[model samples]
Target: MNRRISVAIDGPAGAGKSSISKVVAKQLGYLYIDTGAMYRGITWALLDQEIEISDTAAVKAALDHIELQLVPVEDGLRVLVNNRDVSKEIRTQYVTSHVSQVAAQKAVRTKLVEMQRSMASVGGVILDGRDIGSVVLPDAELKVYLTASVETRGHRRWLELKDKEDITLEEVCRTVADRDTMDMERKESPLICVDDAVVVETDHLSIEETVQKLTELIRNAEKGERHG
Candidate 1:
């Protein structure tokens, strides 16, 4: 690699950003970050401490003590919350359900965004989250907004949750669309595509193709910066 560049990937649920971001990071020898998981880890912390999701004051206090760490691993990232390994715990359905709520808090967002910025200051990171390009790291070398039709994204989520639970495509579509609307309509920081961000519609794309597209974007960005 000529130079390490930070990549920001923003997308709604089941848009294939996480998997493709990981693969792209690995191919570029960069650190991969799932910002969604950071929120999930925070939710796990709050739940483990029995903090009410709606109690903003207590939630902020609890967030004061919890530490979410993203450690580099060979294949994927290892997520740690407050010294304990809550990687698997954060992925539970409970955490998934509450993560958006926890993340919507301004105080919580402030803390996590600070942590994310500290982690990505060194570059060579591919971060996937709702606000990475829009709010988290606006100056990232390359920003990508991944998207797909609600029906397509829903079907993908259905397949992913097929073995885990009995979720139908119709239910998946409704949930996915609802989540998308919530993420975009939230008052804290609506998920929006920022200037200079590349929009990639992943409705009919493979993970490999998506990764290649993102990697090419980063390469071109780096090349332009060097020449300019």
Candidate 2:
């Protein structure tokens, strides 16, 4: 029997990390760990409890009591905080606006990164997030820095949000740019493509095409690991 391996996909916002990772995981029979949703869950909890994100002490205190669970659903993943399902709540505009800063918080990252590491320790897991390959799972069997042009990512994000929000394309593009800066400049575990990670650009590739490409990389990695 072949040993299951861990795959880490890191990328910027609007880069289709979540969607691509989901398909790849399903195809490979691996557990997909939605690290971004975990961060969003924390963000939602802080806002729900009225805890100021800038207040580091308060944020650390809240972490002690907060509990998060990621349950897989037919359509997508469901996030639960303290036993309460906030799957839809975490995707709201309010949470979307504040998630970057919340994710940047050292205390928040520390707590969540530990959980993410534990979850991936068993292998056969595919995790996509800003820092999965760089920080959470540096030793993942396959590390992919999936990305695309800023304009492309912005347009994709805008399309995803158009039906849910009354935001314009330009505004969505600006938001994606702003998020890129935050994710790259943040003090804690900033988004970066590790030296060993394979960079996969999706500027012109369809979701199916991108998935096919990554799936091939993963299979090759598995073969190499087995023979090595």
Candidate 3:
């Protein structure tokens, strides 16, 4: 039997990291881990417990009691906190606005990285997030830095929200810039591209196109995989 492998896909918001990662994982028969959602789940826990984000010690303590889990489903993945369904809850406007602060916490990143590594130990996984390629899985068989123009990303988010919520294109554009600022300025694990990382520009590509390119990258890498 062939050994499993790890793939890391990193990108800014609305560049289709979540959507592309899911489709790519399904095609490759690999488990997909959304590190962003994991951070959001922890943010949800902080809000539920009325813990303040500024207090680092308090935030770290709160995380000890909250357990985050992911279960694959027909629609996508289901997120659970303490084994309770919170997939939809974490995507709310509230969580969307606050997740960055929660994720910015250094202690929080340490804990989450530990969990992500434990899950990726056996491979057969594709992890997507801002820092996955640079920090979480630097040794992944394949690393992708997926991105699109700020305007394009905003438009995509606008359409999604217009269909399901009340977010405006202008608002999303601002959110995109804000996230980029915070991520780039962050002290711990700022999102950066290392040497030899493949960058995918998705401004004009279809979702299928993005997945197809990534799939080929993996197939090529698997040829060079090491086995005992």
Candidate 4:
């Protein structure tokens, strides 16, 4: 029998980590945990209450009212906060611009990391986030750092948001660049690719191509673990 192992996929925003990881988990019949969505959930809740995120004390207090859950559906995962589904709401421009600030909070990271750790304590789980390989799942059987050029990522993000937002491509690219700097420079669980992580650059690859590549890597990882 093949072993069921934890897989950690880490990368910067708009790098397709969440989308690719979701598909990979489905193909492998593993549990898919979207750590980024959890942080987004917190960010959304804070905004809903009109709480000032800069006030660390208020943010810490707001955590008590937030209850996040990731429910699986035929289409994909549905993110819930306090029993309210905010899957689409959390992906809004407001949350996207502010999630980094909320995520950087020590209190937010502490609470969400605990939840993430509990969800992945079992094997056959795949998690995608900034610090999954570096902090959340250091002992994961396979660690993949999926990335692409900032321009590519920005273009992709712009494509996703063009219909919903009134932003220009240039503005989207600048936002992506700024997010990269903030994510890399943040003090709490900043985005990083560990030495053991396999870096996959998707500058020219289609989604299908990337998924196939990761699926093959996962199969090889399982075999290597069996022998080792």
Candidate 5:
């Protein structure tokens, strides 16, 4: 059997990291680990308990009591917090707005990064998040920095959640911009492209095209690894 390779996809918010990583993982038969969901899971739990996200101590305290699990399902992975499925809940606008604050906590990042490392240790995993390439999986065999224009990213997100929420495209665009600033400026594991990571610009690419491009990147990486 061929050795399983770890893939890291890192990018700013609404850059299609989640969607693209999922397809790439499916194509390569690798486990898809959405690190952002883990943070969102915690954020949802914090919101459920009414804990202020900016209060690092409170967030860390909450983390001590909750368990986050990502279980693979037919459609995709289901995120569970304290054994309760919060897969849908975490994507809410409230959680989306507060997730960056919660994720920036040092203790939160440390714990989640540990969990992420444990999962990727087995290889054959595609982990996507702001810091997957820089912090969680620094030595991953394949590191891809996927990005798109803020307008494009916001438009994509608006399309995904517009029917479910009472938000406008402009609002989503502002949120995306805010998230990019937070993720980049955060003291802990800020979003950045590693030196060796291949950058994929997806501003104009279709979903299938993006997936196909990443799939080929993985295949080429594998071939290079074998030859090396």
Candidate 6:
């Protein structure tokens, strides 16, 4: 059997990590794991059960019985919690606003990170999240830290949700900024680029361009590994 390679993509919210990672994974015939969705899945459960985000104990206790599963569909992956599909529900503004708090909890991070590691154990996986490169998959074969201007990111996010929600550009920008602060200031596994991670700035690049650039980077890295 051919050895599998693990790719870690990390960045702040709205940096296009998820969308780009999915295309790159598809091109390489690798599994794409959206770690952010896993956290959002937990947030969905907490909201569904009315568990207060401020109550760390309640959140930790709730996680004990919560099960998160990622099922691949024709378009992308669907997140399931306890056999029920909550994929679309988890992406709401309410959930997005509260997910940072849930993700900051040490217990929640520990559980989800373990599951993520297990899923990528055999490699051939592209894991994307705020802390994938720094925390979840530090030893991954290739680590790419993707980033873009906050304004650009906000615009991308707004475009994705303008029809579904009554949000303006200013609101989206503020939300994106707030998320970056929370993600960077969090105590556990805060978002940071590891030393060896190659940084990819996508401020001026199209999605296809970003994916093609990353695919080339991965291919070169694989070649170097084989030649070395």
On lDDT, the leading prediction is 4
What would the per-residue lDDT of candidate 3 be over residues 132-205, giving only the tens digit for each residue?
88889988888888999899998887887777777788988998888887887788888776665788999889
Off by over 4 Å in 2: 225-228
What RMSD does model 2 have?
2.0
Residue 120 lDDT, candidate 1, scale 0-100: 89
Could you say which candidate leads in TM-score? 4
- Which ranges in model 5 have alpha carbons more than 4 Å from their true place? 225-228
Sorted on lDDT, best first, the list reads: 4, 6, 2, 5, 3, 1
Backbone clashes in each candidate structure, one number apiece? 0, 0, 0, 0, 0, 0
TM-score of each: 0.92, 0.95, 0.94, 0.97, 0.96, 0.96
Candidate 3 C-alpha RMSD relative to the actual structure: 2.8
Model 6 scores worst on lDDT over the 10 consecutive residues at: 219-228
Ranking by TM-score: 4, 5, 6, 2, 3, 1
For model 1, residues 1-228, the per-residue Cα lDDT tens digits are 467888889988889988898888788778888888888888999999889999999998887698788877776878898788887788665676677778889998898888889888998888988999988898887888899999999898778777887767898788888778888888887788887778899987888788788888888877755212
The TM-score of candidate 6 is: 0.96
lDDT for 29 in candidate 2 is 87
What's the lDDT for residue 166 in model 3? Answer: 77
lDDT, candidate 2, 58-135, per-residue tens: 999999999999989776688999999998899776788889999999999998999999999988899999999889
Count of backbone collisions in candidate 6: 0
**Superior candidate under TM-score, 2 versus 5:** 5
What clash pairs does model 2 have? none
Candidates 5 and 6, the one with greater lDDT: 6
Per residue, candidate 4 scores C-alpha lDDT tens digits across 182-211 of 899999999999999999999999999999
Tell me, what's the RMSD of every candidate? 2.3, 2.0, 2.8, 1.7, 1.7, 1.9
